[model samples]
Target: MGNSFSELIKNFDKTRDYMRDFYIYGFKTRNDFQYKSLRTYDDERRRIESWLGDFIKFSNSKKGKQISISCDSSKIEENPLYNAYRCKSFTKNDIQLHFFLIDILEEDNFISLNDITDRILDEFEISFDPQTIRMKLNEYIKEGIIISRKQGRSLVYAKSPDSFQRLAGNDSDKITDMIKFFSESAPFGIIGNYILKSLDKLNNLFLIKHNFIVHTLEDNILLALCQAIEGKNYVSLVNYGKSHKKTEIKCIPMKIHVSTQTGRRYIIVYNKQWKRFSALRLDYIKSVDILEVCPEYDCYLEKYQKNAVYCWGTSFGAKRPKEGIEYIKMTLRIDEHNEKFIIDRLKREGRNGSVEKTGENTFCYYGEFFDVSELSPWIKTFTGRIIKLESNNKQVENRFYSDIRKMQKMYEVK
Candidate 1:
């Protein structure tokens, strides 16, 4: 039986050698297909060999001297192949075994099989079966070396810290300890460092947390919209109307708008049946589904881009004169206290214009809007501080009065 096993091993080695030689020298084709295949095989073999070497090193580590590799177990579990073979016991043992090896390697800077099994049994509270340990280590080596290192006559093992911080060109034990501390405490430190490193190349700097639910939802919405657009599929969305009722609408998603006022993102979609552009709040989108058919309209993405500054919401479907400019000129009286507040409000609402000091404490503000309705409430915010000098649109003037009246009624107490 031993002779047969030896023969089988010899045969496998010979076969591998033959394939390696064939891949290196025997591939001569104009199509480049065979050459590509040979290159891929070589790459794969190199990768496998590298990982195997690391695994052997990791398995030979001593107690409290293992290399720790930073990896999220939950992420690994998400893969279907890994999930299938993953058992709770296996995961627990694997993590402990890796940690144990890491500790041993870090302490002594080298490890052997004898040291590893003994420490595994002692620290992990698992009875050491040499055969089982050997098999598992070999299997893990084949899988990948999450963290490991080679040393004289044996291997050292450890976990990869989440991130690393460089010391001041000084190789000190204290700095190494600090690196470990930061890795354990601040996993995102590495990510922040990378961002700062390439700040010069970035057009915009957006600092956000990965686990933030609102940002996650916004990203999902954008992804879905891009997918729909690429697939030429229409979408059915549920939106909250003026009546505050959930209204179902089938629309072709054209563009997405992010509002600085509320820090909320919205979708600018063309409603086919209604033949108009409707602004749908991303949060209010109850559900979205891809439809089979595409809408038959020349998408006005560029036109919307050019007129975004004046536009109110995404309702740009209404036809207006191309040369006409919509202006909402208003006079506001502000005390020294409210002057800064009004300017900040204007910037928030994205109303572009200039503020000129008309009086000692008052200012004349002139702004253009595609729809004055959108700016009415924003203007009305300075109820006591503002008095309308002229309003071209009666609806806007009425809305300001209505808002003021509502505020007055709240204080009426009659």
Candidate 2:
């Protein structure tokens, strides 16, 4: 959005990087910092504490005063950042101006800037300057919170028309149901929350089992990234590495990928300087700016696709094929009559694994992947059923046995 947002309130999104970096990688000492200034860190730390006071902790040691967040983030129903983002703070002038302007404009009648300022002074004892009121109203108009129109030579203002009024005559029951489902389910569901709240009948109907509330914070960045990807444009990303250090990179954003298991999201970008594909975790991505459209972006994907088959996670890495692309094939012994469930699950979870019967109760699976090691966990699920497992990479097969032996030794000792 515009500069007017976030600053008006001591919001969490404003101090996002300050809190997240520190939360993930806490400060052992005040001076050991990547932030520009100590004053900047103090300001942001205080802002973060205001929202996450419950989770904040401090310690005194040889490393000086250390700050860290203590919470099991996965268990939280809503992201605390979202809760703070929703926390709206206002100045004394903001409160008075809203009431003075809204009370007059509630009737849907438009009036000039002079009339509004006069109404505040004469009707409410609040003496606000006419020029100041005009500027304030202009900000509201830009935000679409209020409407300003030129009625002949004089400019007039009013509260923007209610969209609810247009939907009032339609099939309300159906509309309310649709609104309830989407408001709880869609990204930026908060945007639809106001409308959903208006329909009291729809309240508390949805008890989402797997709501990813933190995804709401990523909506703006995701939109920008997706827009750049669709337009085939380069983007400048300010991101943090595993070391919790800041770095900026210019890359062509090729695609967005999400994990079905965890619902974590990532953007796969091709780094021209490194001449390879790198997947940036969307949660770790601080900000993105779409650069000019690039014609050669898709050419990077041609190389990426060859390697993507081996990518078990978003770790496509900085270069190709010392991280070799290989063929992986396996044979599982599944009795058709007794193991319909296992057979169905294998088919459902297998992205592109081909299934064929090689013997009476045995089935063969064939697939090509860059890294067969990635499929180890899924392969382990079929422990007894895996009669034969072969791959071009010998290390993968050896690691699988090593894991199984370690597990056996632990259980035997127990």
Q: What is the C-alpha lDDT of each candidate?
A: 0.51, 0.73
For model 1, what is the error of residue 247's alpha carbon versus the real structure, in angstroms, after optimal superposition?
6.0
Cα error, residue 253 of model 2, in Å, equals: 2.4
How displaced is residue 228 in candidate 2, in Å? 3.3
Taking all chains together, each candidate's TM-score versus the true structure is 0.43, 0.75
Per-residue C-alpha lDDT of model 2 across residues 80-158, encoded as one tens digit per residue: 5554455678778878887778787743788888888888888998889888788789888887779977899999988
Considering every candidate listed, which one attains the maximal lDDT?
2
Put down candidate 1 lDDT per residue, 319-407, tens digits, no spaces.
55244446677777777575677666655654466677787776777776666666665666667777664566677777777777888
Cα deviation of 6, candidate 1, in Å: 52
RMSD of each: 22.1, 5.9
**True-structure RMSD for candidate 1:** 22.1
Lowest summed lDDT window (length 10), candidate 2: 1-10
In angstroms, the error of model 1 at 302 is 1.2
